[model samples]
Target: MTHTFEPEANKPGTQAGPIPEAAQETLPVVYQDEHLVVINKPTGLLVHRSPIDRHETRFAVQLLRDQLGQHVYPVHRLDKPTSGLLVFALNGDVARALSEKFNDKTIKKQYLALCRGYMPSQRLDYALSVKLDRIADKHKQQDKAAQPAITDFTTLATCELPYAVDRYPVSRYSLVLCEPHTGRKHQIRRHLKHAGHPIIGDAKHGKSVHNRFFANTFQADHLLLSAVGLDFSHPVTGTRLTLNCAAAPKFIQAIKRIDWQEPDWAVAIAPKWLAHG
Candidate 1:
């Protein structure tokens, strides 16, 4: 089964009038087919409704559903502040099959992150206890064993800025490509933090001095992490599918301001995708 990209407003016999509030927001469609749809979700948009952000009026799921005029099932999630490729299954059976692939660790995911300090290519094998939310995980167990988590990181580029954001007179940062073998919550951010190179805008696991410096200097306020690529087999057809997208505009602008070049692989994936606003 194959599906084409057609918004509800463009459908036949649909009356045109004042657009509803939900239709106002549009998520960038990266890839769409009969069984799955991928979107380059913007930063600060939740995958779905959550108690953590009760006041957020808009979400990716809601907006995408409104745009497609059909229900979408999210197979995975990105943090509220992280932006990049997000996949959604169009139906329940496909959603379950994709979820199983994710559960079995068959899906290969790649992320780009701007982190504090220069980092080297390395594989981090760590164990992380569940980071439960007070309101959201209220009914969950208080104590759980740490789960095994592993991530492979490669330093794409590095830059040193002449500013005293922290104790050092010159602050250094790196453009990192992260591939996590496990899907633990906040795994990349936490692993990078553990390695002493937390992502630039990670308020929970990063340094405030650098975060503030970037915000004040470059006006980049969102997390520097982006889910840039995903490689997996099509749930319906056994063919492999590779989906890639560029980071948010703010993220690209920050890289430009810092004079850091994106990796060749990232550029090759989407040449014009890095065109910053």
Candidate 2:
């Protein structure tokens, strides 16, 4: 789905406007120099075009391109529902170098997820090596086209909502730090689903009952995934670089619903080994 670049918003020097309220001046620049640019991307924005979403005209790539007035090539993708630090390169050399970090798994990316059930106080160990069952609809199961996926999650805090379920008491919530060893489409979502504790507001892998509760209670309409931190080598300087972005507003709002404080782990928790690598 290719959206035509429309230079509509006129700000004297720049073109493109009537910016959506969500797309207002919230693009926080974490790090930017001659080589690369990294910023906290807002959720509900597409990174690029795909066969699925054709009407999406305003994307991270296009928005940044217009903001910078030069081509900013995307180095990685954050699912439309996921928001956090996203990297882009100003030139092909930087793009290639940064791509290598991701391809070799040298870059460490960490996310904060709010799950439906109580995540074990102890570290949750699980491997999601499930076959990719690509079906036309999510309700039906297709043949297993397996892929190796692994996720490590640790519970930061847990709480019970005031609302009640059918027979059970109030529902539970867990704030978890997720480290994805592999970047598959919806890997974290699926892994948490396989673990029997899907992330809240996950339309594809989560339960509708919990989603409705979050929306009605917390006003959350998107998935609860935030790319809280990332570490990689500077493409231009070849020096170790680390950047972190705060959890999205919706994430903060949801946490308020459970009456919990953001823990120290909510800060960047990538492995120390990546700094040496």
Candidate 3:
């Protein structure tokens, strides 16, 4: 959670995490319209810049701004290390509308994650409030308990790596679908860790042994979680709007290496983090 990075006066982007000099156009636009825009954000690129990443220029907000040639506002943010669906508002009116929905827990979000160890067979509905690890706060801002965060998770598939993973015999991992009822900084990552199934490739809370294995074998270095789906009532149209995005290529590739299968929703109703904030 702690980084030794120092602030740079010349380059704001560089003070944050690694930022590409040029804006990334490769982010896929999953859904777009006059009021809202959705994109499949890439891993390793920040949604916005922080003090530590001040020198970096590559960010979701900036890229979308340049691509549209107008100002767009972010309704919510995803972790820089996580890739998946992201939503934006085209104007302040839309921003306020969407923001209200999110604050009221009317917006529904789903994420895909690969985590170490086995998850409970039953569905999980938990509330979490994270106290930001001061170490992650490069700006040295006021710190307090994060907003009340709630996340629900269901295990889709569980697989054990065939190869030996250090001292553990064939590390067990799960493909879980997460639905977050509340948005908090690093909510998914912190909640998964709290469940004792820290996400794979999450250097912050994940085991170093597992991270080394993935890095050595797959050359993957970011967290194995993605926000794949979101649903909410359109602020302007007053109609139901649902959006879904696919897992990033690297995450898909990693999951493909393991034996996996999807579960049938034959019955049951659906129910519904971090030190390095």
User: Tens-digit lDDT track for model 1 on 11-64?
Assistant: 211226877866776777867778988888889999999999999988988888
Worst lDDT 10-window in candidate 3: 268-277
Top candidate, metric lDDT: 1
Per-residue alpha-carbon lDDT of model 2 for 1-277, expressed as tens digits? Answer: 1111111342211546575553354355666677788877888878877546766776888777767667888988998889888999999988998888888888888888989777764333454444443442345565555656667787877776667843467778888888887777688888888788899889999988888888887888789888877866676676777676666677666665566534543343333211211
lDDT of 3 by residue, 1-277 (tens): 1111111222122223554556435456767779988877888888887765767778888887766656889988888888877889999999999989988999888888888888864444555554555556544556545466668888877866776886766778787888877777778788888889999899888898888888787666678887777888889988887776667677766665665544432122121110011
Error of 3 at 163 (Å): 2.9
* TM-score winner: 1
Candidate 1 lDDT score at position 11? 24
- Assess each prediction's global lDDT (C-alpha) against the native: 0.84, 0.71, 0.72
Give me the runs in candidate 1 sitting further than 4 Å from their true place.
1-18, 260-273
TM-score of each: 0.90, 0.79, 0.80
* Model 2 / residue 140 / CA error / Å: 22
